[model samples]
Target: MMEEDDDVTQGVLLRCLSLYSRGGGCKVGATTSDEFGEIVGKSYKPVCGAQDTSVDCFSYGVEKFRKKNNKKKNFQLQEPNHNNNEMHVFLPDDILEMCLMRLPLTSLMNSRLVCKKWRSLTTTTRFMQMRRDGYYPSPWLFLFGTVKDGFCSRDIHAFDVSFNKWHKIEAEVLKGRFSFSVTSVHDNIYLVGGCSILGKMDRNSSKTHRGVLVFSPMTKSWHKVASMKHARSKPVLGVYKVNSNHLTIKSQHNNFFRTRQRIGGVSDVYEDPHRLSVRRVSRTSFEDQKSKQSKVNKSVKDCRRFLIIAAGGFGSWDEPLDSCEIYDSSSNKWTEIQQLPVDFGVVCSAVVCNGIFYVYSESNKLAAYDIGLGYWARVQTTPPPPQVHEYTPRLVSCDDRQLFMVSVSWCEGDGEIGRRNKAVRKLWELDFEYLTWNEVCVHPDAPMDWNSVFVADKNLIFGVEMFKIFGQVLEFLTMCDVSDPKMNWVHVSKNQVAREMDVSSCVMKSMAVVHL
Candidate 1:
């Protein structure tokens, strides 16, 4: 049942209990004598009847009243029936939020459908921040898939990493877009500009859409937000929070050819000028543009309260572009920061750990960039020894400033000299104090292709795999607990949702881990 609806029911039940607490006197409009008699009839137990206290009777009356009334028609929670002229319960907004915060996440999500007021109250930035601060809802991972079969769809799914439960989020608003950059601020997911279709278009074409869309999981709905001044696809999205204010930091994509086109080396075939854009979406309303503009200017002027950290990424042309820049949200501008070390190769992926940005490549080599001190250092860890065939290692960040490494290796079979991929989904935790990695546990028989990993605060890791095997696409969600020291990988969920589509054609368009 909807939570807001439950609020009304709870009010009535509380009033009924209060009446029974007062020795079952029926005041006018409080409850009819027949209703009081009926409640009394159900409250008394058969054998222990006369010996029970009035408190027990009140509790029983509450249960019976709830069961009886819930089966009836839906009641308007916000308004009391005027024909009966019964008093309705109402609480201040802050009190209401506090009461709502006690509910589980699933109940809170379903509460959005109760009314517009409930939806707005739960979806506000302030409410989301409160939820995070209170740790009301567990952390969840959102996965979005790319377009396939001539249709663009969000294909998004959510998983509660704490309870190992998969959930559904309404993502109709994310349709018709691919490669959109996704990042989370508190409990909301933001989708930036991307190609509306699969095909490539000219960079100067006006057909490109620079719109920004935001989805609040609490409300299970999406809404449009401020758009970027420049169209960006596959941009690096990061959330910069300073002094309790949030500013979305978007690092513009710089094509390797972007510099070449400027020096007259090539014509304007695919020219997307690289630049940074920072948008403040922490506000609940953007209707007052003039006042908002003034507020934005004031905020930008005080930008020195936070320091910006830049992480280098691989360029579009497969060239190693070591350049990086820092965006000062307060100043409403970006400054070119330190370039990566000269030997930094093509970055495969990156994650923030211990307030340091760690960039890793396909090889075992890694470089660390300090966000506060603005210093770069090559992280020294002993790489696995060379073999006849080498498998690329992947990194995942767990809770409590812990880093994990998933090492991949292969084995050769006998006789026919056939090769079999041996993937040990080992969970290794990094000890920052000692600058060492410790093997927590290993799943030696795990599949080679895990699409994504989500880490929970309890040291449980969720690895999801959606791929094809023997012409049949399969989806597998596995969970393992490193904190237990003896736990093995276990399958939590599986499916064949991509039965009609080839696995190779499916791509993960967007994915983000959010703390609810």
Candidate 2:
């Protein structure tokens, strides 16, 4: 559910009456019914006798009865009060379901087990009114991974934050697919490339599967859609959500509502007025501003293409690469962008925080990429003096307001395997805005060897894997409140996820998170 309201005292005052009476309880001794708006948390007040006080009387009676009932732990025959008129009343199943659906997502999920009716209401379309009212949440990350041990030749893992768990998705992949890459658009995570079932496994092979699959947890189903333009198993993919009107302005100064693109054709310009929180896409957004004196061209009206940038993979971290590409959802064309910064060794877990992309490197260095302006800049701060590289650095996004690094750190490095006294610090956080790093300390009682983790939902979680392999995980995710500068790293031990490359978890296997 949404966070608690500002006015803690004003809560939705629900009424409960005896099942026989079919009336509800109320707080004040009101003569008539009233609409309950606010949500209160603490103790309530008792109103004295007014017109019909049955509601309040019922409320008081139920509370006392419940408290007393909770005290009886042993099973024994108890005398029933035939005259007790304080039992809960049942409202029409549908109306009450609507009232329950209005609760926060968290509350609704927990309440599902209270009764069979509650469970059905929470999971059904009739009870899904919360989603339409914008009371539901934005789509979440789904990390992909393989279940069987071997070369990890499977593609069916996705993490759903709404369910607070991971899902193993079914896929139609080439036999021994081995590797794949993923990207996100709207609520769907696209599975793009992998070894084509009947093809060769040669280097950066064209044997990559060309199909794309999308999974939506709300409906809990998988659907295959169009394929990418070319066969690419490990290509980097980035998920960009832009408000067309606001994006057309090219500056964050404008006060426009956030817009989520409706699933557009791979070549079509994506727009959805129905999904916008507020404001509408005006004529200015679709026009090409060729000149102040000329009317905008009309070709855009005929066909619009939304861009999905894809870059980097399968070569030297120092490779002078510049063929950045965008998947045109409108035309189904995977158009390549010309001059992407080439010096940085881009990795999948890399993130654009505070306007710059923080990419960790094998050189034990942190590289920053300017996502909005397209430039590669090294984090000016010096790398931790010892210079470790074996273990992976999990990038936890801090208060991800605009995707700039609030902190960056890692666990274990490729410390000499046969050497003596090998000790690698597991985590660090660098506030990019401040150019500072603080090593986070794990709870003394918790596990120290963290394999992977990602930030989500204001909390952090760490995952597990045997041996030294990074386990071929596509994304690491968890919710964490990791932004405060004063927060102690000793308490910051964290991870949000791990999913296969084909089904993105974080960044929906965001390009930076995919072929890093």
Candidate 3:
């Protein structure tokens, strides 16, 4: 008798699911009330009425069973319905969150429109934290471009890795700006050092600004922040996080002792009978020095801030600058730092990994700046393959530990007599300890030209390809998973917004991956 009752309860749950899926209401007969109540607790009741009331009986029944069995779980159901024969279900907050978290990003976003409660639940801090920790959705690739008029395009195209679809985000704040460097830190996107028109009518009177604009995905708004001291155009921008744990007093102490030795060197040499007079220093001066040093150290160790490094860009006169500056979020100031190596030339690509800023220059040399140590050193590595011609290298950092290099080269294809030229792209991993490069994979179908390459979460590398046909430019996106053994290149679809723009005048500015 128990076995038959269990079978009947399972059948009822299946029927309810089928009805819900088909947009029909579930109706439980009087005969099955006993079995239904047995599954959904003794308090379960069905309501019969003219107005249709839909409920997720499938989830409700399972949750009730789990509770009755004393199974430890993270979620629980709400109070059971006691009115009417037509079942009206109300799910508890925890149970609803569990169901929503399993949805794909696109579906999850659409679920917000279902009702106010669902929207509020998904946007809660707890929900976002859980989603991020659980890696519910993959990262998105954002591509910024400029229209023919030299103004930043309002339409920002974002490609979803999991769904393989493109989404458009409007940037009304950046509509009138151009020549800005784009970088993302955590959840915020920064637009640094750009030129903007003074007014709508005075387009001829334009000026370069050191202002920084920040965009937040959660709020979908842009706001201006503290500007830089020097105006820069297309600067090499990177973000470094400084924590109290990383700052050490040992270095500060060593520097203080070095300064003391320098000051007392001559005084010590004149020691002897007059040593007491020569060694005597003002007590107030010593106390002031000690107090200043303590204050400086305390401020540095007390708060954590992100350092924005701006290096090597065009100055006001369109001259390439080797000067470098660092922006401190704590004090909201930009302090000039060590300049780039004279031989490094103009920086082509840069990335921050493990608190070190790595930049590749047009001179085909790679160099790294240690933010903590305040020093720069050129990275030594083997040259590109002999067959590669016109090699262009780009640096990408992944997971804050691994550094990968993507290079594109033109090569001659074998032909009977006349060889054809083709583009070949290769991926290499850098061993920072040994400063050696290991070839990861070679793309079989490389586009004629590559605009930018960026890494999304999970070691997925995306490359934007641009080529011209019939005097019009076209762009294509390709991706490769470094974690995959095959590591084959997969071609993603072209950007639909790019198709709508003036292809002849459109130029790709920057590409970055950020979690939404």
Candidate 4:
């Protein structure tokens, strides 16, 4: 019965649109004699009366059809009557759905206010499915992090790829929590376990929380999902779609030398486009594999295979993990992979590229782990850092293929009478295929100290940082195109009236890109 009603609705809607496009001079089909088609014809009268342009005419026809169809006794209860003069509309629902799928998220959000029909269409499950299936453009970068004020904020800022603009939204439903990891599986952004921000003033007093959050772009809302079994602070998060209906989330807590380790995962099935039905999996699968550590034997150890260690004591706070784990999504388990060489003790950053994990160690060396062969090798082709005393190295993976290494260094140049110290940052792209690094120029005047939460997309990098400009505190939310010849960094947050609000509080913790 429901399918029949849907077919009737579609037929009536398309017929009204056909007549509307011809300026109502054309006749509708014989179905117009039925009650459903009769309401559609009556709805067309008010729509044509409100026509101001071709676009508005089509919109009015669709909106009117939707309004009058609801008045039918079989469909549902009747809606309030709309003034003919005020009947604003756009494309037919089916056509509107297709058009909206191509729009950037910001414009799609604004479209919700156009009329009742648009609002209903944007929030429907079918529309969200379209977004998940790559009908829309590439995802936008979303940053939820801390600023300089020491107060964590629930506010989030997003960068739209279509407009090249950044805008803010109230997203901290976890009550201003920070240190969480953000992962986008399909249409939703999952906020994994991180420390609570409800009341901690200092880092030492902060407490870790196991709460997991899921944000839906369609509804512009956040809701609680399944929490991790172990409380984690600054965990490493990764998401993989097992199939059309299931997702496997792997998260490692920041216990093993701040490098973190995989505890367990929530094997979730899709309950809807925005929500998941989560079930906790046991750690024993990964834990039991630890007992078979000796199976690798002493021969493999001497043959360039490293020993994978288990989590025991909390290593030094200042040290990085010498070991790392590999997550197998097919089995829904994590296995202790390999240990870093004695010469490579601490790692500054790590990223996965081409099915392999690459880590930048504190010793200024690159380590590569191949998942298929289950072994580690050092890459000598990594670009060397600048010859400066104070420097920080970061590894960023852009859109799952391009790998970039960003370095910020303090350089001192000899002056006429003294020495001047200036901050210099450089961008380098690493070609994994050929194992070569090419330095991409960053503008000389670009602000330094870009050591806050940052994200990289296809050609743009979005970073948020606090700086003191002429004794005034300023927070810069910036976007830069590394692929551009000029390598310009644009300040996206400068034009907003609420820019000061961002400076007063709001520190960015983590960033992720979502498709819609």
lDDT of 4 by residue, 25-136 (tens): 1122322221101112234211111121122322323333332352323222233674333222233566667666655454455444444455677788777777666555
Superposed model 1: Cα runs more than 4 Å off: 1-95, 161-165, 170-173, 191-214, 220-320, 326-335, 384-392, 411-421, 431-436, 450-458, 496-506
* Best lDDT among the predictions, by candidate number: 3
Better of 1 and 4 by TM-score: 1
Candidate models: Cα lDDT each: 0.50, 0.38, 0.61, 0.50
1 against 3, candidate with superior lDDT: 3
* Clash pairs (backbone) in predicted model 3: 46-84, 46-85, 47-84, 47-85, 47-86, 48-84, 48-85, 48-86
Instruction: Please report the candidate that would top TM-score against the real structure.
Output: 3
Error of 1 at 113 (Å): 3.2
Runs in model 3 deviating more than 4 A are 1-90, 148-151, 198-206, 241-305, 328-333, 384-392, 412-418, 421-423, 504-506
Q: Per-residue alpha-carbon lDDT of model 2 for 271-369, expressed as tens digits? A: 211112121344353233324323333323322224455455433222323344445565555543333334545454454343334555445556543
Ranking of models by TM-score: 3, 1, 4, 2
lDDT of 3 by residue, 450-500 (tens): 455455454777877666666666677888877789888888767444544
Candidate 1: 10-residue stretch with minimal lDDT:
270-279
